[model samples]
Target: MAGYKFFMFDPDNGFETYKTAEEAKAAADEAIDYYRGDAGDGWPDEVAQVCWGEIKQETQQVGLRPRDEEDKSSCEMICDYQLTDI
Candidate 1:
């Protein structure tokens, strides 16, 4: 399951691993749904406009992913990962 690094950049903060692009998208979807449930269809947009005066996403910029075949910048090299107990 080796692959090139996937960097997740937060506009308000530093970079971190998004695990995969799909995971990043799923996280965004969940956030939007939760906010919409609490507010309305335009929940996220409305909140952003009121708070920051614009619309923004949680996952801001996605960094460059190297070519997998070349095995450049491995995911492990980019992200801090460890196991945890339940």
Candidate 2:
């Protein structure tokens, strides 16, 4: 199937994407859990708080903007998860 892009926002980071909404949301939750130390040895409260704040701001910003229909090859929304810490 042809790939479609979805936009997702990360608090600490900026914009991102996933092939599907489910994939993007799963990634976001995983990131939150990981940062919060659900897996153990989580990030410091200060760091986590800052990161989360950034993500929340970004999400809101993107949500307020108009959707881009020109980018058919990419998801319309952004993915807010990262494999590495920012």
Candidate 3:
């Protein structure tokens, strides 16, 4: 198979890049497990958002909540976190 890079995001841990998708997923899963042990409910929504690119919002919510949540959206959830041509 073709080579690919994996990226993971953590609030306290920042971001990490790995040589393959499996490595990246493992890192992310580990991060979630760590955070879940420490942060409780606040962790998953953020981690899930990172692991999954899409975010859902209702039309009725106003202003900052929607916008703030939008800012955290990531398109690279299940794929390469960053691309380096070299």
lDDT for model 3: 0.53
Task: Write the number of the candidate with greater TM-score, choosing between 2 and 3.
Answer: 3
lDDT of 2 at 12: 59
lDDT of 2 by residue, 1-53 (tens): 12534444556556565567676676666667656763366565533432211
Worst 10 residues of 1 by lDDT: 49-58
What TM-score goes with each of the models? Answer: 0.32, 0.35, 0.44
- Predictions ranked by lDDT, top down? 3, 2, 1
Provide the lowest-lDDT 10-residue window in model 2: 51-60
For 3-61, candidate 3 gives per-residue lDDT tens digits of 33456677657766666667777877887787678565454555564451111221232
Better by lDDT, candidate 3 or 1: 3
Global fold similarity of model 2 (TM-score) = 0.35
- In candidate 1, stretches whose alpha carbon ends up further than 4 angstroms from where it belongs are 1-16, 41-86
Model 2 root-mean-square deviation:
14.3
The residue pairs that clash in candidate 3, if any, are none
Best by lDDT: 3
